[model samples]
Target: MEKAIFAMIASAVVGVFVYPKFIEFLESKGSKQEVNEFAPDAFKEKKKTVTFGGAVFVAVPIIVMVILNGFTLNRDLFLLIMVYGSYALIGFVDDYKIVTEGKNDGISAKTKMAAQLGLSVVFYAVYILTGGDNMLSIPFLKTPINLGIFYLPLVMFMLSGASNAVNLTDGMDGLAGGTSLIAFIPFAYYAYKVGNFGVLLFILAIIGGLIAFLFFNRKPARIFMGDVGSLALGAALAAVAIVLGKEVILVVVAGVFVFETLCVIIQKISWKLRKKRIFRFTPIHYSFTLNGWDEADVVNMFYGIGLVCMVIGFVLLSLS
Candidate 1:
């Protein structure tokens, strides 16, 4: 608990102090967000804002962890940092391309998927080799069900899905990062309960970093996290879920992310099958935007829903 509080305080302090400089640096470097052509009018106002500020949050935590906790070379800790850093790098490249080239289509979907797949495979192999379970824990059930060798594909799916889910949820200011901090609270507690201090410390650091980011990430944002922050956070969440044998509960706890992704999938399927669109826009948040809801309203409502899901996750965890 003390460690978690310290991590959070340190991260928030670093974020608060560093954010202004980071924004200045991005502007000086001519890094700005590209507004999608089809995006709502509200987004147009955010066009010139510097993005990928998530790097501040990501960097502060890792640097603090290494300096304060020291490197243990534990496989789980090593893999978590590696995967998180790798995804962040990919996101940074994507954001950089968009900012520099003035293209919203930063990287090819194929290339991104290939990179994600490679990372997922490595993560799964390392996990299994280190004697991690292939069985998944059912959310409301006490028993763990084995997936045999199918665990490889499952892990890939979880990682890819989580990354995209978080990416899709990044539409609003502080929406993704704020909700993620809330979601991580329980996971951090669970890690501590399980005596996984390394994972606990890592999570606490992330939570702290995000809290600091939120200072700038709030509505009418000064900077956006972009895909770089979103993807790394998603990967980190998946990795933690797998480590704690709580992947199944993730769907429920991260219901907002699931709903966002499902909305997109449904929109795509409906477009193909019926030549009709369901929501005014996919990801649901944009639907709220299309319906004339203010960005703050949408953010608050989504966060409320996230809090509810988190409470339910706590209940589920207790039952388990």
Candidate 2:
């Protein structure tokens, strides 16, 4: 418990102090965001914001976890780090392409999905070998649903979907970071309750870093997490749920991300079937924004929804 607390504080401190310098360093190197051409006009305004700030927050937590865990190589932590790192690499590649090549087309969608699946397969293999179960814990149910052969695909979907969902939710300032930061709190509690100190420590570290990132990530942002931060965060967030055997709780805790993804899917489906777009832009947050809500208002509303779900999830976990 003490270690978990320390991990959170240490990483938060790192995020608070390191982010400004990191932003300056990236800015010096001409590392900045390039707007997606398909993005709404409002998004184009963020084109010059320094990006890939996810690098510092993501990397700091992992480092803090290692130090707090006494440098011991726990199998679960290793798997978590590997899965998280792989997604970060994918996001980094995209961010790098955008920064260096000066284009929004980073890695192709096909290539990115392939890489995500490959990493998910590796994670599944390691998890099973490490005696991980094939059971999926459904919220509010005491009995676990065993997936058998279908488990692998589920893992693939969770990992891939999480990464993409977060990426999609990154269109607004602090939307992704703030939502994720709030979501992690309950999960960290779950980990602590289950005596999984390693998971708890890792989450606390992430929470700390995210808190600091949110400082600059709020309205009128000085930095953007880009696909790099969002992808890595989404993967890590999903990975933690999987590790804790609370996959269903993830849906509730990360309700905003799920809602955002559903909006995109629904919008696409609606366009194909009905020949009309459901929202002015995909992802519900932007729809709200385009509907005349202030960006900060949209973000705050989503945060409220996220908080409610987090509370609901924590209660369910507690009852279970």
Candidate 3:
């Protein structure tokens, strides 16, 4: 408990203290964000903001953990950081391309997906090799249900799917970071209950870093987390779920992310299948802005929705 508390505060302090300097550095380099062509016009002005601020908060936990724990990680901690850091690396590359090329399309979709999938394979192998369970904890079941051979694909999907889910949700100020901060609450609780201190500490550290990041990332933002932060956070959540056998609960907690991704997918399918659209904007959050809602209202509403989902996730965990 002491270690966890220390980790959380330490990470938060590091991120809060480092962000202004980091943002200035990125601005000095003139590394501004790239607004997607499909994004809301209001967001086009976001192009003036510095990008890749994720590198600070995303690296905070790992750096703090190493300073305290001494460059050491058990299998579960290894898997957690490995997945988180590697996904961040991928996002770093993607962000690099976007910033340098001066466009929202960063690296080819095929290339990005390939990197995510390839890293999933490596993480899966580590899990299996480390004697992690091949079983999944099904809600309302007293015993875990074994996945056997199917676990591999499921794990791969959760990793990459979640990575993309959070990525898709990062379309606005404080949207992704705020929702993800709420989403990790249940995982942190359950991790403590299950005695997964390593996973628990990592989650708390993330939550802390997010709390500080959201301070700057809020409306009229000073910095954006960019792909590096979003991708890493999603993968980190999924990896913790895998470690704690809380995958099902993760879905409930990350409901906002799932919903956002579905909005995008549905928008795409609807557009292709019919000459129509369901919402004025795809992410559905931006669509809220279309209906006389401002960015702060949308973010606050989603934060409320995320809290509700967090409560529901706890209810589901109680069933187990």
Using all chains and alpha carbons, the TM-scores for the candidates as numbered come to 0.96, 0.97, 0.97
When summed lDDT is taken over every stretch of 10 residues in candidate 1, the lowest stretch is 33-42
Question: Model 1, 1-320: lDDT tens per residue?
Answer: 67656877898898899999999898898888755433667676665778888798889988877766655546667778878888888888888888888868888888888888889998998898887879989865667899988988989998888987898888887899988887887787788777887788788889888988888889768888987899899988888888888988888788889988898899999999999998888777888877888888999998998999899888877776
Looking at model 3, report the run of 10 residues with the lowest lDDT sum: 34-43
Minimum summed lDDT over a 10-residue window in model 2 is located at 33-42
Question: Which lDDT value does model 1 have at 115?
Answer: 87
Candidate 2 local Cα displacement, residue 15, angstroms: 1.7
The whole-model lDDT of each prediction reads 0.83, 0.87, 0.86
Tens-digit lDDT track of model 3 for 181-275: 89999888888887888888788888878888987888778888888998999999899899988887888889999998888888999999996
- Quality of model 1 by C-alpha lDDT: 0.83
